[model samples]
Every structure is written in structure tokens, then in C-alpha cells.
Target: MIVAGSPAAWLDRAGYHRIDSPSFDLSMDSGFILDGEVYPGGDLTIREARALRFVVP
Candidate 1:
């Protein structure tokens, strides 16, 4: 699973050619805050990825 605060950047870094996901909804109740960071919605499911490089700011 991918929890991408910046989806575009994650996709580019992971070298994912396509994004195929089911249609779903995100509500405020689903939002969560971990430590001091807040996540607005659910994590993404990356069916495939290559050359993945994750860097934390």
C-alpha cells in the first residue's frame, strides 16, 4: 500500500505507468493523524511499482 501525501511525486518516483483503482469515497471520519502529520484520506493501493525510492521530508 502507498500512503502518498503527494501522489504525483510518489508515482513519478515509483515509475508506475498506470493507476487502476476502484471508485471509492473518502469522508472526514476516515481522516487520521499520525504523530504530528495529518492524512486526509485512505492509503493508495499500488498494484505495481518499480525503482521505488521513498524519502521523508
Candidate 2:
């Protein structure tokens, strides 16, 4: 639900509980790996995701 002109957007945090997803892992306000690292923090090799924003990953 991207807004027309806003430079930033955020989803309601509560929406996570109401949605249905097949994904076994779910991320909250941050990416999934902050809970545990399959792709460890600061790793550049993993292109798919990062544990947090501005990380080397």
C-alpha cells in the first residue's frame, strides 16, 4: 500500500497477527535473522536479506 508522495511508509504492526502466510518464519519490526542468524550479521554474502537496516549485509 504505497502512498503517492510520501518518502516513507510503514505498516501497522498489529496487521501481522491478522494475516495468513505460509512462511514458517515471520519478521516483526525488524528482519527475521535478529532472532537468529542463518546468514550471520554483517555478512555480505547473503543477498536475499539483512538482519537490520544499514548493516554490511
Candidate 3:
């Protein structure tokens, strides 16, 4: 995985097309700052995402 900046930016700089991933939930690109730097902490599942999407939308 490419590590640089935020997870969202990673996608744009990926310089490729289509990721062979089972699920790429929005939460998969998150984190909690401990001191000052950023961190990755998004780990959502497909089933959970589907449920949330259906209920929310």
C-alpha cells in the first residue's frame, strides 16, 4: 500500500485504475492523531457497509 498524506489522496495519486478489493468503504481511510502526525484507522466491512448504506440511504 502507498503511504503518503491522507488515505483519500492516496487514491488520486495511485496512478492506476480499479483496485481488486472486495470492499472499499469510506471509513477505510481514517485515523486518530496521537501527537501531531496523521494515522490510518478505517476498517469497515462490506456487509456492514451495505447495511449502513441501505438504512442510511
| Pairs in clash, predicted candidate 3 | 30-41
Clashes of each: 0, 0, 1
RMSD of every candidate to native, in Å, equals 13.0, 13.6, 11.1
| Best of the candidates, TM-score | 1
The number of the candidate with the highest lDDT is 1
Error of 3 at 28 (Å): 9.3
Candidate 1 off by > 4 Å: 1-29, 45-57
Who is ahead in TM-score, 1 or 2? 1
Cα displacement (angstroms), candidate 3, residue 44, comes to 14
Native RMSD of candidate 3 (Å): 11.1
The lDDT for every candidate, in the order shown, is 0.60, 0.38, 0.56
Model 2: ten consecutive residues of lowest lDDT: 39-48
Query: Residues 1-57, candidate 1, lDDT per residue (tens digit)?
Result: 355434576677788655556554435548777698987765643344456788999
lDDT, candidate 2, equals 0.38
Q: Please provide, for model 3 over 2-57, each residue's C-alpha lDDT reduced to its tens digit, 9 standing for 90 to 100.
A: 43334566577777444546565556456767589876777644532344334554
Relative to the true structure, candidate 2 has a C-alpha RMSD (angstroms) of 13.6
